[model samples]
Target chain A: MKSAFRQSMAWLHTWVGLLLSWVLFFIFLTGTVGYFDDELDDWMTPQTPTFSATADDSLPVLEQFLATKGADLKNYSVSFPVDRTQPFLTISYRDADSKRQRIKLNPYTGEELTPRATAGGQTLYRMHYRLRYMPTKIAYYIVGVATMFMFLALITGVVIHKKIFKEFFTFRRGKKPTAWLDGHNLMSVMSLPFHFMITFTGFLLLLYTLMPLIMNAHYGEGKEGRDAFFKEYFSRTNVKASGIHEPSLELKTLLERADAEMAGKPLAWLSVANVGDKNSIFEAGSIHKNLSDSRDKWVFDANNGELIKVQIGHESSKSFYYVLRSLHEGLFASTPLRWLYFLTGLLGTGMIASGMVLWTVKRRTKAIKSGGGSFGYRFTEGLNLACLLGLPAGIAMYLIANRVLPLELSERTLWEVNSLFITFSAFILVAVAKAIAKKADSAWVSLTFLTGFLYVLVPIVNAITTEHNLLLSVLNQNWVFVGVDAVCITVAMACFVLGNYLNKIFNVKVNQQEHSAGPDFKRGHAS
Target chain B: MIILLSMLIMFHALLFLLLAMPKYNKQISVFPKRDKKLESNFRHVGYVLLVICIALLIVDNGVGVGIALVCGLLTFLGSLVSVMFTFNQTNTAASLIWLPKKIFGVISSSSAYFYLVGYGVLVTSFTLFF
Candidate 1:
C-alpha cells in the first residue's frame, strides 16, 4: 500500500514538473546565452576596431566634440574603448540650457555615430529578465513563479527517486522511459550545484517580486516608492555644472595615470561625466577578470585629473551589493569557471526540456490506452515538439538574420527578435502537423537534423557574409568567434547522434505492461 | 525582517514534517492501504516548498554566525520532527526507539517558540533602532 502511495506521489511530481518545463527550459536557455551576451555582442558587431589608446589620446577628439556640440553638454558620459572590437570611443551629454537636448560623440574622431536608444541583442537580454509586453514588476513576478516551480521540481525529483545514487552512473540511451528518465536525471543531477545556484539566485535576484507585500505595505502601490528608493540608493548627489570653458584635459593621460596607479589592471570602461566642466569626472573602471576578489572603478576628476574615488573603497551598502551581484553573474570568475557555468546552464536547459518531453512521452501510452487521441494528445504532442526543437531553430535563424539583414536597415533589432519568434512559431506548426501524422519521433529527429545542418553551416554563412575565414579567426586567437563556431559544430554532432537513436526508438512498439516494469532486477545495478 | 522570516520558515518546517511523515511511516507501510491522493499531494507540496526555502536562503545571502545558527537549527528541527513523527507512526516494537520520539517532540516545539520570539525581537530591534 505504501509502495503504491509512493508511486502516486512520484506520478504527481512528474506531471506537475512537466507542466512548467517548457517555460523553465526557455528561461535556462536564454539565461545561458546571456552568460556570453557580451562576447556575442562583440561577435555580432565586429566592425569596431581595436582601441588601445588611453583617455589622454582621445581628449583632443572629445574636446573638439564638446566645442562643436557645446550646447548639449549637460550630464554627458564618455565610454572609452574596452576591447579590440569597439570602434569609436563614445561621449553622451545633454545640453545645460535645455535638458532635452542630447548629444553623443565619438571621442576618436569627434563625430556622432548615433543617438541614444536601447535595441538589438540588448533587447533580448532585457527580455530574458523582464520578459516582453508586460511591465517589469509583472514580468519579474511571472519569472519568479517559474523559478519557484523549477526549485520544486528539483526537490521533488530527488525525493521521488529511490535510486538516485545507484542511477548516478547509469545511462541506457536506447531504452524508452528509462532512457528519458536517465537523460533527465543525469542532466539535472550532474549540474546540481549550478541548478541550485541558478534557481536560488534567480529568485533572490528578484526578491521584490516574490514578497511584493513587503514593498506594497512599506512603500505603497505603483512606481512612486520604487522611484524614491532607487533615487536614495543609487543616485549621485550635489551636481552643479561649471560654466568655465577650458581646453579639455587629456583624457588618455588621465587613463594612463589611473592604470599606473592600479599597477596592472585591465580596463572595463571609461566614463567622462560633465564634459567641458571644471568639475567633470573621468572614471575608468577595470574588468574583474581572472580574480576571485577584484575592484571595479578607479574614478578621477577630469578637470585637474585627481583621483576621486575607487569603487572598492566605498563603504556604502551599494558597493557591498556588487560582490553578490558579481558572484551571481560569474563576472569575477576565471574563464574556465565561466565556461563551466555556461555548460551547466546548457545542462539545466536540457534538464527542463527532457523533463517536459518525458511528461508527454509518459502520457502517450495512457492517452493511447484511454483513446484520448483526438485533440488533447495532438495539442500536447505539438507543444512538446515546438518547445524541444522550435526554440533552437529560432535561435539559429536569429543569428542568420543578423548576418543577412542589411546593417543600415531601420528597426534591425526588432527584426532580430521578431525573426526568433517567427521561426520558432513556424517550426512548432510543422512539428504539430507531423505529430498529427502519428510521426512525433520522426518530426523530432528531422528537426534535430535540420538544426544540426543549420548550425554546421553557421561558420560558412559567416565567412560568406563577413569574408572572415574560420582559419584566420582561429589563428588570430579570436576565441569569441572560434568558440561560437566550435559550439555550433558540437551541437550538430550531438543532434546527429540523438537523431539516429530517436529513429530506432520510435520504430519499436513494445507492450505497455512490459514498458512500465520498474526495473530489471536481474541486471546488476551500481550503488 | 529576520523574525518574520524565521516565523515563516518555522511554519513551513512544521507543515513539511507533518506532510512527509506518512510516506516514510514504517508502521503505516503494513496497513494494507494508503491514501494515494493525500500522500502524493503532500509529497508534491513538500518538495515545492523545500526548494523555495532553499532558494530563499541562497538568495538572502545572510550575514554573520547568528544567521547560520538560526538556519542550521531550523534545518535540524525540520528533519528531526519528520523523523520522529515517522518513527512514532511506525511498527517499531522496541521501547528504546520509541522513547525519544515523545521527549524530542515536546523539547523541539518548546524551543521552536523561543527561537521564533527571539528572532522577532531581533527584527523589531533592528527596525526600530536603526
Candidate 2:
C-alpha cells in the first residue's frame, strides 16, 4: 500500500513539476531579485542623493515646502524616508489639472531631486506576481494557479522521496541523471520549510483574487457593496469634507503624537484628507513591519490637535492575513535575514531549473534512440535552455541598458523594459535554431558563456556611464551600488566557470565519438 | 555571531549523523570494526546537539528569522559537505579530526567519535561564551 501511494505521488510530482516549471522558474527568479528591490530602486535612480535624516526632522521641512505650493494642493500625501534605501521624502499630490504628480525631495533641505526615469525594481517585484503586459486580474489568476501547482509539487515531491532524511546528506556531483536528481533533492529538502512557507503564503496573498466567491457572497453584488465591504474590513472611516474653512495643526505635532501612540515606531506616510475643511482627518501610518499595509496608524482631527483613532493591532482574522502576507513579502526581515531569504529564493530557483533539466536528462537516452526525440521533447529542451540561460542574460542586458541608454530618451523606462524582452527573445531564437540544427550542447555552452560575458559588462557599463562606480561607491559608503556590482561580478564568474565546464564535457564527448567512429564521425552523426 | 555559531553546530551535528551510518563508516574506513552501539549513540547525540543549536538560534534571532536562517545555512553547508565528500572522499572525514587524531591515536581514530566530541566541546564553549 505504501509503495502504491509512493508511485502515485511520484507520477503526480513529475507531471506537476514539469508542467508549470517555467512559470515557476520565472516567478522564483524575479521574486528572489525582489528581495533587494529597494536597493535596486536606489541604484537605478542615481540622481536621488542618499540623505541621513530622521522622519521627525523631515516632517516639518516637507510640510513647510508643501505649504508654499498653495492651498490648491489637495489630496496629497507626504512619505518620510524610513531607512537608508529610501533617503528622500516623497510628496505626491493632485495638481490643478487633476493629474497626479510625485516628486522626491532632499529630506534635509526640501529641494526637489529629479531622478532619471526607469521602470525600477518595483516593476520586477510586481512582475513576480502580477506579471507584465496583461490584465492584472488574469495575471493574478495565472500566478495563483502556478502557486497551487507549486504547493502540490512540494508535497508530492516529499511524499515520493522515501529516504528524505538520508538523501538530505547525499549529493553526487559529475554524474548525469543522478547528479541532477541529487541537486533537485538537495535544494528542495534543505530549504523545504522556506519552499512550503513561501508557496502557501504566496497563495494566501492572492486568496481574494483566486477565491472571490467569499467576497461576493459576503458583500453582495455591485461596486457600492464592494466599497462598503472594504471600508469596514480595512477600518477605513468615511469622513466627508466640511466646506467651512479652518486652519489645521502642523504635521510635525501630529507625527510626534502618532509616534508616541505607536510606541516610537517611525512614521512611514501621512495622509491629509478633507484638506482646508473643518473636519479634516490626518492619518499617520507607521512603517510596515510585519503586515502588508502598515498596521499601526493614528488618525487625528486636523482642525484641533485631538487624537481620533489609534489602530495598533488587528483582529485575529486580519492578523492572520497580515502575518501571512508579510511572511511572503519579507518586509520586516532584517539585513541578514533578508539575505537569507534572497539566497534561499535563489536555491528555489535552482531547484526548479534543475528539475526542468532533469526531465530532459532522464529522457535523453530514450529520445536519442527514438530518432532524435519527439516535437515535445525538443521543444521542452529548447525552452529549458532558453529560460535558464536567456532570462538572466536578459536581466543583465536590462541593467546594462539602464546605464548605457541615453538618459533623456523619450519613454526611457519603456525602452529599458523592451530591451529585456528583445534580448530574451533573441536568445530564445538562438536556442531554437541550435536545437533545430542538433547542436543543443554547443548552444547551451555558448549561451552560458554569452550570459556570463554580458553580466560582466553590467559593472563595466555602469562604471562608464554613472559616477557611482564600484570604487567611488565603496569610497562613499554607497553600499547599494557596491553590493550590486559585487554580486554581478560574482554571478558572472560562476557563469564563466559553468561555461568552461560544459565546454570541457562537450570536448570529451566529441573526442570519444571520434575515437569510436573514426575522423568523420561528426559529419556522419550529423547526417 | 550567534546564528553563525549555531549553524556551525547544526552542520557538525548533521555531519555526525551522516558519519554514523554503516555505509558511510565503511566508505571512510575510519573504523575497522563498526560498533552498532556507538552508531546509535552518535545518532542520539547528533539529534540532541541539533535541538540545542536550534534553540540557540531561535533565542538569538526570533522564530521566523531564526528558522529561515537555519534553513539557508543548512542548504549552504550541506552543499559544501556534499562537494567535499565528492571530491575528497577519504580525507574529508580525516580533516575534521586532524587535531584530535594527532593527539589521541586510537580514541580519535573513529570519525564518528571525533564528531561526537567536537559537538560536545563546541556546544559547551558556545553556550558558555556566547
Best by lDDT: 2
Chain A TM-score across all models, in listed order: 0.81, 0.94
TM-scores of all predicted structures: 0.68, 0.92
lDDT of 2 by residue, A1-527 (tens): 99999999999999999999989998999999999988888889876676766677786677687778778865678777876446688888888898988888888777879888898888888889988789999999999999999999999999898778877767787788899999899889888888999999999989877887778898986677678778889888678877899987766776666666767677777888777789888888777654434477888887776888888778889978887777888877778778888988999999999999999999988976786688788878888899999889988988988888899999999898888889889988999778766678899899999999999999998898889889999999888999999999999999999999999988997788668778576777888
DockQ scores of all models, one per candidate: 0.02, 0.49
**Pairing residues by index, what is the TM-score of model 1?**
0.68
lDDT tens readout by residue for model 1, A274-310? 6677767777766554223345677777777778776
User: What DockQ does model 1 achieve?
Assistant: 0.02
